[model samples]
Target: MTTRAGDRSDGTTVWATPAWRERATAWADDELAAQGVRRTGAVEQPHLRPWSTVLRLPTSAGSVWLKAPGPGLASEVGLYPVLARWAPEHVLVPYAVDAERRWLLLPDGGEVLGRRLTPEAADRWHLALAGYARLQQRVSRAADLLVAAGAPDHRPQRLTALLEEVADDAAAVTVTDEEREVVARARRERGRVEELAGVLADDGTPPTVQHDDLHRDNVFAHGPRVFDWGDAVVAHPYASLLVALRDTAAPYGVGLEDPRVLAARDAYLAPYGGPTAATLRVVEAARTVGILSRTASWLRALAPLPPHEAADVREAPYRWLAMLADGESL
Candidate 1:
């Protein structure tokens, strides 16, 4: 039970600080002694961008990824066990080297899927999405089990609350007239999409688990293995599809209308009960609202400003606000 530098009151260890590193090393040594696992030593890997810190630990069993959670640690921990049970076939299972320490060991077998998603890589994308679809089916089944256990349904409501907060701040944020228009439209569209949740839930459609945060970075594809399961949620099945579409559009340079995009979406949904065209549209709209709200906050905090980048950080909230107000989808 050796403690690390960034060890919180709850005993979760933060791997970023020197004290935590010492503690982590000590804990690893102890765990190895208990489990008969041989340690190779700590290998420093470059940290991933966009926040949080991760390190690669070399061990005799295999390489393990040590991720330090920021504010969302508890939420991620709560979600992982559920995903492990529900989507065991599709996700990488996290081995808890130290639960109290918040030290996670994941098999380092997968390559990032984004790297393989080239225009010529249509088949790979299709395979990836198909696997994703199967994962969603399991998630839906898990959601039902959670509901039966009286777990609070937080997915739909969280997005709704975030949008409302964005709307409240939209009026005060300064932005160009064009960006204002975008924000206004987004606000209105968000309202319309929010209203459809009840309809979607009540229409006798089975709920599937969703990876609410399904960015390209979250997915890794090595040979046939996909990793990272921290953000899985039991909610709308199409949520991941929307994430794929959104991510593919920008950094991946894949357009929404691209044949591969459409094909991948279809392949992902084909095995599960297929969602109607309208349902897909609603999911896409809902996801856009969520993204805009997040982007607004990020822009405000990071200050991605004028003279560089497409739009100013200060303007993002307004643009999203205007888009929502006008009922437009990104």
Candidate 2:
């Protein structure tokens, strides 16, 4: 039998191994029986990547998903109970979590939002953004709990040091001379990150769970449930918009400044202050410095990836950090 841990000498992830699958299958069977849900068909391994793996189990009730993250991303398993407690309406409470193994068994979260760009899609974006904003507001009070449960804390006050750390790390900034220059500029202007942090703090919106990635596919169509917390961080809530607006608008051939995008932005901002000039300023600042949080998330996930596989993906952290040099491009 294959070993239960460690990648293959050839650099394959362990989750693809029969030994790991056997352990996961046994655990899943026990969990399902406890819930009185019997398996009705063969289990399917639908997603397996360097950072995580997802197994789809057919059962009496319906299909349930089992996700196991690589060690670097294990915190995602511990986060669901906290999210369920704080924003039950917006995210699912996992059926069970194996804290030791970092695995989560979750109910089917319904259809993902459509990828097509349409007026209807914009409406869905508006609701998803607004609903996610509410989730952030609700989850704000659980910051300490979330941190204890392993969510990375990228709170506003910590931005300056985090900025310096990422900008100075050679491993994170190994790309281009232009990116090098951007990193240098970012280091010199580290004070600006501190200033932005102060502005956001004064705005009275407490730092909450920032889904470092919030796009159409991450949210659901049948309801407001948002999944994929592996990249989540506890930071200035508005920081989430950097990814939300950019990714959602890209497929539609629109930018963040588009009318549809602005409406969606306002929808998200409604919970905070509804796009007032001051709020917009705060948001722009958050989205700018939030780039570091994005870089940090990528670095965390990329840490354990095989060097050969991560050569291209490794450029992401530096690329995002370079955005700090470009002012308010969000």
Candidate 3:
């Protein structure tokens, strides 16, 4: 059965339903028990969306988090073991994973980065991105295995094809006439999209695992370990900067050109060769293509939801596509 957020048109609601919660709770308890841990209090549902939901279990050991993803994100269940093996120092390997149920039991990774950028947090940001880049470099060697394990394949060369697929799905992008025009214009710019992808591919930084939604909240403050791999993809490594720099800097009222943002960018690029003009151009191109990668990921997340259930965020993919209509960096 497909798990959706709150769609009960079929006379059933999967997420948050009594039976679903019971099963998830039983599984989480079993997983905890296997590790010699016992729950000390009631489970709490902290986050719920069309794509996934999270449960917080207070335990003898501390707090363990249980994540149950919607049908669209079932791959994330399988990616945890792979990430744990590849970047053990940079991620919390799940305590237990139930791939068939699309659930993961993870230990409470420490505090997350502060919402706003402070002087003290700047170094942590730099360290997080730098460490993440190193992890990407290592993952590049096993890029194929990443895709095999369920990370979306967003390689530079494949971006235009992804765009083409989304564009043809008019139902997915067209909410208004203007949005339709946005899709039409994006389709015509297919060549430009392919050209940018080529630039990124030729830049010599091999495609690797990119946390398409990498930002402050996703990185723990301790190891500064990165988590939340549901939005991950195999893409140009620099493509990650789109979210790391732009999204991270936004809450602080800074743009990518801001010194702090630039510092973090340089930190990540250091492993790839620092921020020379050539590398910066590659960064810009990667950012441009990264918008589509975000779009593709959103499309996947939104695919299995009923129209009403997806209503609030359904415009996301087209909105990202609209950024490309002006041929500007997103």
Candidate 4:
């Protein structure tokens, strides 16, 4: 079961229901007609993304994927052309976009990588990492353009400021005892986090585009196309690995120290240069900062939840903050 409609971090209460279907129907119809598709109905893809609504519309030729950004967010339509200029093959460029309504239509990119990850997993992950590295390098030159297109400024320099702001918000909200504890723990470790953030910023690392959420499912298996640019950022390129390294490792029953995992990480870093112990140090701190930013964003989402829905939403983030702040390795 999914989080109740009222508990969703995104403000929209309309999702996976008739209401959401009705609103998206018009967009689907328009895009289908433009694509010369002679279909009368569309189906909602059974996906659990909390950020947007995706509809799979069948056509005489192929399927068309239509997406509408969730409540109070900018449309990612602008990002396609920017990515195309640098890494066209790695992203699915939309055919038509309605900027005002936060809607876009894209050609179906076939199955997601997660479905077939168990076989040739190493090779697939290496391909993904290498392609992603190229995307980062090319996009670095266009950082300003990407940021204007809705990517957040996720550089390490901004982490502490964002943390403090979220901490204060949590302290002021009085929403739940659980959330307050997360904020309390964050505040307790604020000094150490700030110092590390400074080092990350001072490393003089060439900042590049980061796909903040690069979980396997967001990638296509064969084409190795990347989807879901909603969490894209402009940060040190290695920061991408900090997030991906931890994400891809644990699920496969491998630790960060595992040689196999470290090899793939080396592959990701290969685009920039050979692996070095210094880069490893920055990445170690970056992982914590990334988690801190994510936890703060979650708390922001949790701010509006009612008392009844608060408990279910607050536990994991709270526990993570406590563990990370207390110097426990995740």
Count of steric clashes across candidates, in order: 37, 0, 0, 0
- Cα lDDT tens digits, model 1, 1-330, are 112123334222233467776665666556554666666876674663322456777788877666654332333545556666777666677665444544555557556666454665556666767777776666676785654432224355456665555554554443556765555555566556567555445445466555555655666654333455434444555656646666656655767877656776676667765657765755564455445434433433323222232233445446445544654544
TM-score of 4: 0.83
Arranged by TM-score, best first: 3, 2, 4, 1
lDDT of 4: 0.68
Scored by CA lDDT, what does every candidate get?
0.54, 0.82, 0.82, 0.68
| lDDT for residue 43 in candidate 3, whole number 0-100 | 86
Q: Which stretches of candidate 4 lie over 4 Å from their true place?
A: 1-23, 35-41, 48-50, 72-78, 115-119, 172-178, 300-312
TM-score of model 1 relative to the true fold? 0.71
TM-scores for all predictions: 0.71, 0.93, 0.93, 0.83
Which candidate order results from sorting by lDDT in descending order? 3, 2, 4, 1
What value does the lDDT take at residue 311 in candidate 3? 87
lDDT of 3 by residue, 39-120 (tens): 9999888887767888899999999999988766677887889888888898888999988778899999989986655777
